[model samples]
Target: MKSGEGRVCQNPWLNQGHTVEFSPDGKRLLVGSSGFDAVFEFDTDSGEVVWEWFAWDHGFDRSKLGHYVVRSEAKCKALEAMGHEVLLVDDPGKYEFGIPTRQKPAHLNSASYDSEGRILVTLFHQGAGYVVDRKTGDAQEVISGLINPHKLSRRKRGGYFISDTRRGKLIFIDENYRRTSEIALAGTPGIERSPQLSEYLQNTTELREELFACIDIHRSSLWLIDVKRRSYRGIKFPVEWSVHDVASLGRQHGLRIRGLVGTQFGKVAAFARQLKIIHHFSVDGCEVTALVLDSQDRQRQLDV
Candidate 1:
């Protein structure tokens, strides 16, 4: 095995980089810090920090706001007793991963660039997403009440797709932050659970049993990243099979799909979570341009 040599920046603030993105021209890199409520810009070739933006200093407060409270007394008591304020609880131990906590207000989960060269970023605990003007340092809200938005992908027509991990739903919101459509994840065999609700009142097991497990999406199809089953699947539109049908077929084929990426030719590349690679028959008919691995270990590609 061979390891490639890369320059390592030892800055304490950026030591635990949660996300890294390349600038439009690929001349600079944007690093999101998990340890600090800040974003850092570094010169790719020089490894020098050219700019730093702090979310906390910009009138952002995490402690004052509260997450959605489920209507159930038992769950509410449990969460309250633990001092967990987030509405979504995807993973109790990893509260940050499942939902945003008050301790990390500017905990940015995902980011993307809009068509007009603006930067869009999502804050986990804050229950809001923002679009920042590159030249003016102005920020505008995109959406709210998202159950811990995990990722955001730019759409073809100047909009964006957001993944609400705790809710197991994908919402397509336009540039103005108005939701267009939402799709839930379909459950796989042996892994049946509905998306979590903030109101404890809606936390019934039957409600949780509705699996619409899709987590990500491209322009044409939605990617079913069933974390529970550790598999990937694809959902195509226009007379495609329902989620239940796809899950049934997956059980018969012995295929557990985890991540999906649309190719240039409109096909999807499915990846198995356990395998940590693309499935044998997952190759789509599109051209491959760029490959990226997100914070959740899902693979993504950019193609025409």
Candidate 2:
């Protein structure tokens, strides 16, 4: 609970962390690790497991008429090696499990709470989105035909905007889980609500009351714009920490791993309201280290 310099709470159980999300209650980080083939909750304070669930173990492979079952050649071989005749398609790219993208998704990309209270998550290396029953941990695929979808945030009025970086558009999902509309995006892959941004730049007549944007997290650079006015600027991080980490990073940065940035969760203090920059790092042979740099200074390391 201290700030000034960031902190570190190592949890080795997290492997191939595809998606890192802070719980809505803001207590634990819900990590989707493809290596573990499950999404697990870890303590924000002690880095201990709260609970976890594998997608395959939780209805990810349910028999649905419109849904296609996809498995990698390696997985099919692994299952066959285990004495199961797992037939797989010759071209996995066109399958539900595999999109037209380069990387094959295996776990999840991002998560958010839907109006119905279900935990909505986009599958890794896949073209589908799913919603999970919060209390039971059960899941069901809700949307399809998206090419490597990124962070999806619930809109204030209603529905949710799904950022499809690969496809260069945002698919709008209604409260009923239907793809109602779409928004065109160019270079940015991820987007998040910026309440503090609207408050800070109150004098900007072209800006709206509630701002949304894509950030270069490592440098803490923000691209604030007036989508309608066609006016924008590339500058320093938003002069506020409240909206720092609202949009969770997807499995592959910008729809690819090569250009990814940021060290997962940049603490904004416990619930991440306010945190300071720090200066330090440590590694013990084989443990994951989560690091964060202050948005303002960029050079100063924040809590680990």
Candidate 3:
């Protein structure tokens, strides 16, 4: 795939549109922006905003102030112990708001589409996850107590699992809404765990246990973990300029298409992380909002 290939959702109040998901129908993209506290659907071919599904903003529901925007006080306490600021843990307005000092809206960090055509976003800093209504565009809290939720992954067996970046825990939720704490393979003995989390993904095999993850640190890297073998290896994915968000090519796809979501001004694009590059960000001059299409043809390749 070439640079500046399949790209869209270019600059329109996308301060923290860090997370992007392919539409269920594979014709659009759902971009979740923390800067705007909303998820807007963008036409893949046109790159035009179709509509937005806003996350709960400050004073969203005065009737139930803390309903949709709840946080894990315990998790916040842990992050505070980890050297995060007190105001950042409890009164999070300062994180986003600089002036009036109102509460910060739910920052939609990651997004996924359910079988019912609804978008599920990890409300990271908000300590919860919300499921958006396909028709009304409104959202309701479905998972809470998640500390700085980052990635939302659907399981092959029953339910779903989410990554808590701050706490370093992977929580599992069943179809019946039962929650259980889980440790990613990296946390186990002999397996290396990268600091500063970004995304977690498990392959859709019979066991549904092999995992893939990426670190959002300065020298960002990627990992492939085989739980059954109890072994893992790290790939030195070199990049000069920093990066923030990553989207996975489905497990079924033999092409390990991992797209880099360029924020803070750069091009959005996708490629296999295992590929080595001897180039710098200046080579492209930061053309944000372009990446490889998980095109139907590629999906067909995976299916074959």
Highest lDDT among the candidates is held by which one?
A: 3
Q: Indicate whether candidate 1 or candidate 3 has the larger TM-score.
A: 3
Instruction: Find the 10 residues in a row with the least total lDDT in model 2.
Output: 198-207
lDDT score at residue 273, model 1, on the 0-100 scale: 38
Q: Which regions of candidate 1 are displaced past 4 Å?
A: 1-5, 64-102, 186-304
Query: How many pairs collide in each candidate, listed in order?
Result: 23, 11, 7
Question: Cα RMSD (Å) per model?
Answer: 16.2, 14.6, 14.0
The 0-to-1 C-alpha lDDT of every candidate, in the order given, reads: 0.49, 0.49, 0.51
Of 2 and 3, which scores higher on TM-score? 3
Candidate 2: residue 49 Cα off by (Å) = 1.7
| Model 3 ranges with Cα > 4 A deviation | 1-7, 57-103, 156-158, 184-209, 216-221, 228-230, 236-241, 248-304
Name the Cα RMSD for model 2: 14.6
Once model 1 is optimally superposed onto the true structure by TM-score, how far is the C-alpha of residue 144 displaced, in angstroms?
Answer: 0.9
User: lDDT tens string, model 1, 192-252?
Assistant: 1223423110010111122333422221234544333555565454211111112223442
Q: What is the clash count of model 2?
A: 11
Error (Å) of candidate 1 at residue 280 is 29
